[model samples]
Target: MFESPNELNIARKEHKHLSFSAGIYYCLGGQAAKLEIEVAFNCLCDKFKQPRLQEEPVWRKNSNMHGMEMLMIAI
Candidate 1:
């Protein structure tokens, strides 16, 4: 709700271009999504002892998405 108009416009454009966009419905429930992600990450870290990175990740190219293609975790 506090976001600027320009930021929201950019987001709307990006969402339109993306194939997997979840739309404003997700934004309306962003708090719930953030909480779930936090809980899962915390639980995983707590349960895994001495969890370390095993390898460098190679990101996917020529794509609009910017997430890790491969994340090697040594647990």
Candidate 2:
């Protein structure tokens, strides 16, 4: 569904699918999760002067989910 997976656009609104699924399969905790992530990321950015990846990230093994299991970052 994503034409350019490498691109990052936090303000984009033309998504075909929600991160937490859609309709009857939608997650109730999606909003809370998103808020938590935003807070955490903001905290990290504020605290770290120069944050960077220390090593290659380890991807999760789920076919339906795309995420990292292990990501080592240096600040």
Supply the global lDDT for candidate 1: 0.56
Model 1: per-residue Cα lDDT over 37-63, one tens digit each = 679768878999876668765566645
TM values, all candidates: 0.50, 0.71
Q: Top TM-score: which candidate number?
A: 2
lDDT of each: 0.56, 0.77
Clashes of each: 0, 0
Model 2 clashing residue pairs (backbone):
none
- Model 2 local distance difference test score: 0.77
Our model 2 lands, by Cα RMSD against the true structure, at: 2.8
Poorest 10 consecutive residues of model 1 by lDDT?
5-14
